[model samples]
Target: MTQTKRRWRVSPATIAPVLIISWAVTSAIATGFNFRPLVLLELQTQALFFRLRGEVAPPPELVILAIDDDSLTRGRDAKELKELASIRSWPWRRTAYAEAIDKIMAAGARSVAVDVLWDLPSERPADDQRLQQTLKRYAGRVTLAAIHATSESIGGGLDQLVYPDPMFQVDPKAIGLINYSPEPDGQLRRFASVYLNQIDADLRQSKSDLLSFDEASLQTSKLPFNAPKGDYIFFYGGSNTFAIVPFWTVLYPQNWERLKQEQIFKDKIVLIGPTAAFLQDIHPTPFGDLSGIEVHANAIATLLEDRAIAEVMPDPAWRGFYLFLALAGIGLAIGQVSKRTTPRFVLAIVIAGGWWLVGYASFVYGGLILPVAAPFLAISLSGLFYLSTGAANDQLEKLRLRRTLERYVAKPIVKEILSQPEDFQALLQGRKLNAAVLFCDIRGFTTLSYKLPPETLVSLLNTYLNAMVEAVAAASGTIDKFIGDAVMAEFGSPVSYGEETDAMNAIRAALGMRQALAALRSQWQQEGKTLLYHGIGISYGEVIAGNIGSLRRLEYTVIGDTVNVASRVEGLTKSFWTDILITDALYQRVQEHVEVVFVGEHLLRGREDSPSRLYSLIGLKGEAPTLYHQVHEELRRYLGYIEATES
Candidate 1:
């Protein structure tokens, strides 16, 4: 025989699923590439980012010098002058500041930037000249500190004390206006960088008369010391200025001799700022409390090491393109893979989790922010779209299954089947779950229907069917199907479990159904309705449980010889004068668990040679022994006869 090749036929519905999946997952893949959150975090973290990024800043050359409390106190103790009232008459006196100043000069220091301001004439004029004399001697090397603000009101003090020296002239080589004015919070976030030097350095050039500049002759001849690199670390509240040199260090004999000789004043740059009471110049910085000189030291370090703690974000035009491209790509990936219905949800969860990991890693290690909000948005939107379609198709499959179950089983049974979605799917895939099945039918439905109008017969049948289904449901037995007027049920079907399980549950559900039917039958008789008795048959065995049909159609039902045998056993209820008949296999399992009367053997369908013994399940526990024993003896005798005959 020649084999025929199968061709796939596509319909609008068929292609619709594929298209939807493509569109959905594509949105997810596109959203991930936009790294925007880098800007959202705190600035300190941003500072850390640059620190870790290793971007270098150009070095700046500057230093600080401060006049402190010891000078003032020593002058006072010597009775040099009587406070601010007698400015000119104050007698001069030398203190620790003068001694340290001499040592710093001997240290090969480059430039001394004095950040101290002489707001007023010192209480001791003689003592003040000694300090000014020290500044004047190194006038070429010293950069005098002055208060440069919109208010130049507090003047003359520095000019008179330092600038008015008769022994030496104020060197034009000195830099002027050294204070780094900060914002009210004193946060040195931005470099004082570019603007202030125009005013301050301009003033210094004009006053100092220092020149390397060509007037109108040679087009260019500017001085070498002109360019000021703005890179400087701001140490707000520590000893960057005064060197603290501790009052105690100066008092030490070894250091005192060096201080007197001005040995600390070599080529090193010296910074001086407050580190004592009365002269408060402290502020908080990264490494803790610092003073102005310490700030200068930090600034010097930053410049030297080429360190910048901030990043200027890329322009909007590029940012927009990046975001758009990332989102678009993610969307494409999501849409492409979404066609696999069942796995789509699993894939979405995996995508979301994986994206988080990547984003976190990028942020922590690479100092780069991944576009999480957008990418996640795309994934979620795409996943939701894919999910909706999947759910719709799933529901459609469910409806098909319910229709099939309805044909064979009752409403309650159909509802029970629907309750567990996984179980229902397993049924479609053919899983033998632990479930209880009940098979029921009218006692003389065939004969009774023959005598009555067909319409009236169906009505009566529907009533009994309704009652029996309710009885099985009440006992937790799932009605598998109804063949003509006969019903089939089982102990376990939908859920598969260990061996001893389905047997006991099946017996319980069967016993409960018997009780339920008994009451229903009695009520029907009392009402004068077309009275009918029902026979129930139950079996416990592995069977394929699932939706049975093509893609266009499907039905959830159980199939196997166990289910067939249960039906055959139910059919034999007529041969024996009994309302309920169960096989020996079922009886052996539930014997010790429920109250059942073993009926004598009967020829079960599909088993002509061997007669199967039947049982009437009454209820649970030790309720009715006499009835049970009688039925048991009859079953024993009949089964013995069959066994002997078979041998």
Candidate 2:
């Protein structure tokens, strides 16, 4: 195919590598960029395989309403709040808390837990009166926030949050504490399981000894925790308990809540925190940013239902390892497919896919926090490298072969030689080769050519010469060259191995040539075309053969006196009045292996210094066979006769 044709479509030569390259590049990207995207993918993967083999947290049951722009409308008019001097500076409107608390009292929810700070006493007398009235109406029904204790002893709890009102009219029996002293990390790593500290303080102040006095009322606290190991108790309800309802919802009558008689303030755990804008009581965590109330909810839900991400909190060393593995694994996977463009890209595919599979399996199933980066990139890049490199090398080999062979051989022959690279270089070698060398010349070319038109002579010569050269190569002989109508060939040089049967091969080849020309010669006679004629001499001898001439202009040929005599013998073919003739030396070489019929002895036409025996090669006998079996048998009889005569 031509280059233009190949350009228009994907060929076998190009399609394969292209596919492999695409795979590798994609694999490289997947493996290279390891960050939030990869983690999201991992989470999705976890969702696929994360089975609740142990206990599962109850599903989140609460809905959310962000204390967002919508909540501003319920509190106070933005314009009015800005105009009011004292409130413009204070974050919340004086009456806002009362309005929200009143809404909660009307909602009829099981319990209302206020995630607010009431550490300082009420400021506005009117606002305080309104709040106190609401508090009395919902007495013992609402759980209020305590100002967290910011004890310079580094202690901070519900005390610092909400200060106790002197007119605290809510029923003491219904009151509950909403306080959490959590970690700086914003994770509620530990907490007191029960309100024992409060029980202690409440007793110190009231001397009621509530822990013992509350035996009948103990069911109301309903602390579900059971461990006795530390002053702090760990209570994790199922994931269901961890639901984070929006703080803004507490102001909506439909979405708010009031304590039911059965709540732990009735029969449930109540958590509280600030979600109001000015409060900004939130921090970041692995689960994303969350409110302290939500964190408390998460802690309770964790203890109740025990759901968690299985973290293999690494030793310092493994932390580095985990990071490296994750990034490296992804880079390698993408690199693998990017490197190859072949249909057989299974290696890269299998390997990269395996890395991902392995990472997923270890993290999800095996519960091992492994490094996912390096292995993934290794497989991907390696595949890409292997394929791209392979294609480049293959193209190079073809070009080299094409350039090297074109210098000496014909295109078709060069193609044949290249078709078998294994044997091409070995085609030329120096060896003692016994071959039937054919040298043919026009019988009277000089006179005949003068008689015909130049064009006519040339055409005739081409016809005859073309016919001879075809015959030589067709018979497994190498065409050395064509000298006008005189053609030279070697049957066992550049190609040998049948030299033992050289004499027979030469005879059959010569006969084939003579027979092949009968029709052509007859047709030429009928057309008033000149009859073609030539002399062919075959000889067998050890000859030196290989390519000869300067490096720039070399020819494949055989040379020696054996070749000279072959030419000299051709000069005698016409003199002997035969179309074919060979030296006695060729016949002798095949002495016991073939049969030859003598055509009689003759003096060479060009150099008649000595006469030589000439013969025609006949076929061999299959049984009791030896080369020239008949001649050797006759010679044996003659040798006995000579022995008797000598005696």
Among these predictions, the greatest TM-score belongs to 1
Please provide, for model 1 over 77-141, each residue's C-alpha lDDT reduced to its tens digit, 9 standing for 90 to 100: 54533332221222223334454556566555665554454544555667567766776666566
Name the lDDT value of residue 417 in candidate 1: 71
lDDT of 2 at 35: 41
Off by over 4 Å in 2: 1-68, 77-304, 311-313, 319-345, 357-368, 393-647
TM-score of 1: 0.51
